[model samples]
Target: MEKPNLFSIATKELSQDAFITWLLQWADDKYKKENEHLCLLGKEFAKSLIKLDKKLNAENIKIAKVTAGRQWKNIDIWAEINDDYALIIEDKTQTGQHDEQLKRYKKIAENYYKGERKVICIYIKTGNECNSSLQYIQDNGWYIFSRSNFLAALKAFNTKNNIVEDFTSYLDNIEKETNSYQSKDKLKTWLAAQGFYLWLEKQVTDWNEWNYVANPSGGFLGFWYYFTACKKTKGAEIYIQLENRFDSGIDLCIKIGADWERTTEHLYKVYGILFEEAKKFNIEITKPKRFKAGAYSTVALVKNAFTTTSDEKLDLEKFLTVLTNTENLVAEAALKC
Candidate 1:
């Protein structure tokens, strides 16, 4: 019912390395209840324990343990606090394995008869020793704490209630800030690399003026040129003059559809919508600007460099159809759009 000696915790001399070894052994010997100590723990606690240790070092809090009320079958330790709270300590040694640990803790706490069970698992990982590892563990998600973090918790505040509030704030801040971050389009690039050809085939067929966004990782859009048609005139061999520039860039010049060219204003307004539409379908767009050769550059024949077309087909038709399909069966049939 009273606060214990703070001096002992302040002077608690235990090497982290030694403590980690002992703690692992303790989980098996003192902490284990059954045949295998199969409810494994380690690197996780090393991580969370670090936080607790730091908190202890700072004289903010101290680790307190009670082997539960000794009545429950599954639970081994009831460490944390009581009346009005209890932190359920589990070691999330592996990425997502700690799910069961917390589940079991909740199960024990149901019979705990000691107010609300504010549970947090301490995951000490000797293998990983940085925020990234902690983040990796978190991405897999188990409400686990790293050793350093657990120690940090101890150093900041001593009371169980204080620890709960502090830890809650810590996590809340992390979520508010860290949850939005992504891995620089790692998942997106992976998908693109996998089924890129199929995507290109699909994208090229769509007219209706759409955008095909390129993946930053795409080193020269390979396998995308087959489905694309180059700009052409009424009757001459209309070479792609600039292959690989627009949707229809090829290593060899070919008669492809014209590039979609729009005025700057129309381009911006339509671009956002088309861009969104393309993204929705995972279509990749080219950089710089793609225009019908007439708008920016002359549609000069690659071989002759003199012949020109009266009316060339632009590349936007398929995209427009996809965005707003008008039941053009021939374009659909030929391109397999």
Candidate 2:
């Protein structure tokens, strides 16, 4: 049996911030003699941050102090290193930056330093997030330190400390669980759905956005791509949406532009075009039972959209072919509209 992991119980962002802060504290010179392994790990982490800034070098630098929590304008982790660099880490676990917090935090750090100390901002996420979200973080000028990156760093330093071992084991378990969709016969958990969506984002092209779609009953992971302008209706567009509800089956939906009368009219015309085009690829797309007009209403749906293997697992290669065909079909139909 495996040992009990405290991280499993305390799965909050605050707990994760505390662990990281504790690890960074070992970088102080006072702990070098007592716990060299942890000290080296801490120093390595600091060096990783320093490496992000081209102007600063990690060699011969010592960590002066490390602070966590509400001390430095609510930044998750702040490390003052040797009168040259101040490292600001915004740690996240299963949540994303909101309300322009990344920008706000970066401005606060710069203001605090006032150009005296060079501020290096790092956004460390030890949880599953879509590629789009990660790109947004990068767009805001914060370097991303992802779960895989952190794991690689930890795996490099083999340690026997209980705290390190437990934390590492817990993280390893979480990674496995998040990636479980690849091995499972059926997708059942939200993590698995997220993993599937993230994988799809990497494979698919021309997608504008993807995220969770919340409903009163429950929510599902959704992806939108293949946006084509409607020649028939001005300021209107058509797009494809992939909605994965795990056990409920994947849905391939065609969303038409806003305006009830025009949308309703174009729905039938596009449906006819897509239905015939889909048939060429041995796929079937059906018009929705009832038509509801709105801003981007679902006009057609392909139920059980994913192609499965002989053993009933998701056949990713076959699914990719289906998606490619769908894109072509939609594009061809849009040309006629």
Candidate 3:
């Protein structure tokens, strides 16, 4: 059975301004007397907010007013406590920090804020990790609150309650998605620590004639190695396929970016170049179903190199030789194109 999103909102907006608005409004005390059960939700949320900064005393805190999408240059969510402290929250979903936006926003928030209130900035996201550096966000006195931490606080608040349970289900979904990508990141880090990628890096440096640089964005799985050509050509990669518990194979493939104009003729031309080059090394080309006359810019398997051995361990040396030879062939083909 499909799970229900309580807000009936798009998953993309689940962590965006909509969720922030709903959270802050719930945290506001004026809405408390209206529904005590729902008011508990606000109390729990305020607990998380107060715990965010140790310097702020929760005893002096009073749940006051909440605003969103306006005031202070359109911050995602803003909450005031006891008329003396202001909390500014900025939520980022499926996006990275842009143009020192956090720093700029903090400055704007402080400058635009009125009265003798102490302003605090919070950067909230579904995940704690990002490709960009978040040092500036931390350095500028902004607290980081990931969805994991928020969900933990909510779960601890109350579990059997119906309203909290429904909200938790929604948060669980987002946390599950975040875990999926985080697992891939762990695999990528593990693969980089292994000998294969480091050995390939050495090969690229030693065999400078190939005009190819090693890149690790082969796929989410850690079984592939990617190489980018110097002449603005689509990259080549090799996939490690395990079979029969004792036999492993290397699949030579090409990756075409979406910007590359893919055509059947161009596919065939590149396939022919790779085919002839593999034949020179006594490596037979494998025409998989995916390589059959079709327009695909993502991946095209060109050949396979498989071997049988009784040992349980992988043949790193032999596989490395095969991969380097295949990459050289791909480099030559790219130069011709």
In model 3, pairs of residues that clash are none
lDDT of 1: 0.32
- lDDT of residue 235 for candidate 2: 68
lDDT per residue for candidate 1 within 1-337, as digits (tens), equals: 4233332232222222233343334323334454222113322332244344332332333222222221134443344332222434333321333345545556566566444544443444311122333454455433444434544533443333332343334334333332221221221342222222223335443221112334443423232122232222222111122222222332212222334442454334333433343344433333233433333222211222112233432233443343222112212322321
Ranking according to lDDT, highest score first: 2, 3, 1
Instruction: Work out the TM-score per prediction.
Output: 0.24, 0.91, 0.51
Those runs of model 1 whose alpha carbons end farther than 4 Å from true positions after fitting are: 1-77, 80-87, 98-101, 116-143, 147-337
TM-score of 2: 0.91
Instruction: Write down the lDDT that model 2 would get.
Output: 0.76
Displacement of residue 213 (Cα, Å) in model 3 is 15
Candidate with better TM-score, 1 vs 3: 3
Look at candidate 2 and give me any clashing residue pairs: none
lDDT of each candidate versus the true structure: 0.32, 0.76, 0.53
> Could you tell me the lDDT of residue 73 within candidate 3?
73
